[model samples]
Target: MTLLRHTSKEIKDRSALTINPAKTCQPVGAMYAALGIHGCLPHSHGSQGCCAYHRTMLTRHYKEPVYAGTSSFTEGASVFGGQANLLQAFQNIFEIYDPEVVAVHSTCLSETIGDDMPQIADKAVKEGKVPEGKVVVTASTPSYVGSHVTGFANMVQGMVKGLATKKDKKNGKINVIPGFVEPSDMGEIKRLCKLMDVPIILFPDTDGVLNGPLTGKHKMFPDGGVTVEELRDTANSMGTLALGEWGSSLAAKYLDSTHKVPCQILGLPLGLTATDSFIDALRKMAGKSVPAEISFERGQLVDVMKDYHQYLYRRKVALAGDPDQLIALTEFLVSLDMIPAHIVTGTPGKKFEERIREITKDVPYKVNVKVEGDMFMLHQWIKNDPVDLLIGNTYMKYIARDEDIPLVRHGLPILDRVGHQYFPTVGYKGGLRLLEKILDAILTRKDRDDPETSFELAL
Candidate 1:
């Protein structure tokens, strides 16, 4: 047998670019995140394929029917203009979907030709298309410029900037920016805020909409999300809490700058430290003590950590996904004594560098971090220096398979896995979720590698 050694010299330049992008297209992530809002219809201002693909991916991931529309851009629309198609789409969607709020986000093709989305939105309103209380919002997301994380930020900002209104302040009301988290994560945030007796508003809230129960009747529109009333009143909130570093920055900054809404930025409520910090921020802002019920949750989370300590200790992991998710998950992995050897995110932004450094300062191994790119280079990095495991979405499965490292599926566009959409990845429950997957991956790898003679029934 020939010796096999991984080398940078053999790491092709195309790999330097992107062999397989870890993040989905900008428009899709924006649409997916938007669909979490209640009574909101997310429309793609590009080819029908873009909208269809996005809805399909979300439907599979959430195991629920996702509602969205396309401008139905054809060759003529591409060359001449998409303004007509978009206006028609707006008309048709309102007639059919009839959502209380319409959110329009653009793709690279539309953004490239310099399609002015906000202008088109204004024109649509001029024609008496959109209703008074039922508002319209738009986000410009050129796929070539940034990753899904950027798209999410753009969409969320559109919601706040376009919809938020200046009004009298609400003493108890708060804004919660959970960042590009799963539907279950959204649910947990709301639950925790309720327990703390803090009135909170989560923009693009997807918990009820995405993870809705399979009632005998299937409604095209799901019921869970931050209502239009909430969005309108969010400007009056006493404070805003952004969950992750990147996801929450735009909403926080926009509210603070535009409406003078006070904002607090924190890490995603993933691991213990991050979650505790998030809770403390909320408690102080609400002027309420951490309730005994939540204290019990912290204790339970610690108990789970202790129970799973042996399985997780020093389990080297490589992660690649959206930037905010990568940073949050990296910190969580390190919390479990797991070495995050390689990290990558497709979202392009300067913010990721600072966030990664701040979180990984205590990491035993300095993780190779990349932001605003694809997974192609990430796979190359893993091939060069193999890790014990991989923690990312379905796109990285081949890398794990080739390297013989068991992979745990997480993050957006999880095509190969299900149930995560309804399963909270925040709070104490999220720790249990992480522990279950980590142990299974490690044990499965051992089962595959152990010799028959030496392999025991149980480790």
Candidate 2:
């Protein structure tokens, strides 16, 4: 029997349960965000198992070694609170790892016990667990609450609150929070900004940290990531451009409110429209015209879209991923005249559904959209009304195989494939890569299904 053979074609209303959830726990996202900081150690205030699982998830996804500390909560610590364990963790992390910053995030156990992260972190400092010039930041990321996307946002907000401070004068630079994208995407964003000659401070930038070269020597803290100085100087930047609403907005809003740094919250630059908005925002903020190089890249992407219209037009696609990425992707699909038949995200937000509906309102067919939904529901939808292409993480492959649909892995936890950490899916060039992938999937399917006599060697 197939993996999804039990999936019913009749979609039933489900609440209070999520099978094969589209999102992971919060600690994973927190750990990923913390790794974007230079010389930083992510500490989990919960069971050792939780920390290990979080590390393993990231390590598998990025195909790199991931290091994190845990409170090692036993039965006793779980009831009496893990405060002692956390303080000792701080002492050991500072003494052993010697990281510049210790980013502490809470798990389900710690959050359920109502442990106060701020108080414990302060206690660690008072007890000299944190050495002089070293910093400690804390974020509450309970698994029972929102998904990993929420945890990412919370940790970013923690970074801003703990480090950012206003200076005497503006630095005439921009602060960019790249959201929960791959290191390649972050690098692409930097490249676009550099092309426009705009100075930007991108925090939690994991470009070099996660996607380091295969040198003979191994360094615990790779020489990538945003330095402590840059994070502190974010307040002095002239403005801020937050990339994703869920992952980057909290930190930007905090900076705007606390330090008077003006911010513009935009979607992740995944496809053409989103990239255009990002470039335009950069152009306006920097008071510079759109450079010819960027214009040329945009033209290339447009040319390809026009050239391949026949292959992509009116092909139905089903998507499951984070809200920000899905929004931009949905818009991109619509621009290609492809129908987003069904879309689901585990993150809870009515606005996501509303925005998706608005984007696909003019499509020929009615779209099925859901927030706080699971993959099981998506499979059910696909069973009832099938799609030609499926886009999401590696987990979606099961549904793709069982339903005989082509899959394009695009989001987090893509363990079965590589190159996402090296090749971007954002910006104009990134859009070209994405278009190529979509075309490849569609054409490959056609080659597999079409008769030999009808198969064209030129297409």
Candidate 3:
């Protein structure tokens, strides 16, 4: 008997319900973004349970201890509004934790009750709850509104609105918003910039904060993240590069409108063409030529792809993740002559579906794509039309097991796996890693299913 035996191949309409959602709540993304700020403690302006769920999700995903303060709203606060709870939380967080910044985000409970976060934050500042030089930034992240990707965008924009200020003198630096990626990916983006000899200030940089090395002594705040000064100096930079439209464009647009910073929005650099675009953008913006080292890495990625073309060509793949990731991954799969048979993202955006279809338009087979869809739908598609490989988070494992397909975990809430927090999947180097994973999954399956007599000693 199969686990998903009850699932029907016939696709049905589902508007009011979502089964096994691919995305988490807003507060989780907000807390993750807040942690990217140096010495910043995220505060959830809602019930303690909400904060706990958010923290637990992030902790499991990153395999790190995530700290966050909660308003701890009781029945009384729920009816009367959570302003008092938020104010008290601010006072306690400052006095006890003593962080340099308190990043606050609203939840469904607080938002539904009509609590004004900015007003309460201002009151906290007026009452001296926040000490001198310490900042209190707030983002309206109602869990009912959007997915975690939206929450990340809101919090990043809030950070810019609250801290970034234009100075008379330019810093000759560029601002790079790396989007909602892993800490290792952020580190890779920074390394690429350094190789290009371009000065960049990457905000919400979790490279050192989330992926820190363990030591004998434990510290509440790690030696990573973009500093408060760096956030402020974003306004003085030459230009801004927003890596992903969903996770980073909001903050970049804010800076452009308020501080006259030029902004360019691009997709996440998941493969060859996208990486080239990123490097080209950096080269043009910083007035520098592409470094020989960077060119060599690109050549190596191309060479490897050519060498392994037989393994990846025309392979059918199913993908589910955030919109930004799906867009880039779909294009990459098409480039490798792989059919992206089924694609789904829980985030609601028509542009996501449109972009996916556009990428797969020239493919030989019809593609199944959905925006704001659930894992159940993806499983149904797989049951009706099976793919050779599955690329998604841990949730896809059940489908993989039932369908007998190879799995390549690549998105958020990757609870069962590690190394994504340490290794990148974004740059040219990351592209190589992704290619290696894909080939390994495909070839390993081939080895398993093929007869022993027909097996070759070497490729």
Error of 2 at 69 (Å): 0.7
Model 2, 179-234: lDDT tens digits are: 98999998999999999999999987889888988879999999988988999999
Q: Which candidate do you rate higher for TM-score, 1 or 3?
A: 3
Give me the displacement of residue 162 in model 2, in angstroms: 0.3
TM-score of 2: 0.99
Which candidate number maximizes lDDT?
Answer: 2
**TM-score on alpha carbons, each prediction:** 0.92, 0.99, 0.99
Stretches > 4 Å off in candidate 3: none
lDDT of all the models against the reference?
Answer: 0.81, 0.93, 0.92
lDDT minimum window of 10 residues, candidate 1: 1-10
Provide the RMSD of all predictions against the true structure, rounded to 1 decimal: 2.9, 0.9, 0.9
Q: Which stretches of candidate 2 lie over 4 Å from their true place?
A: none
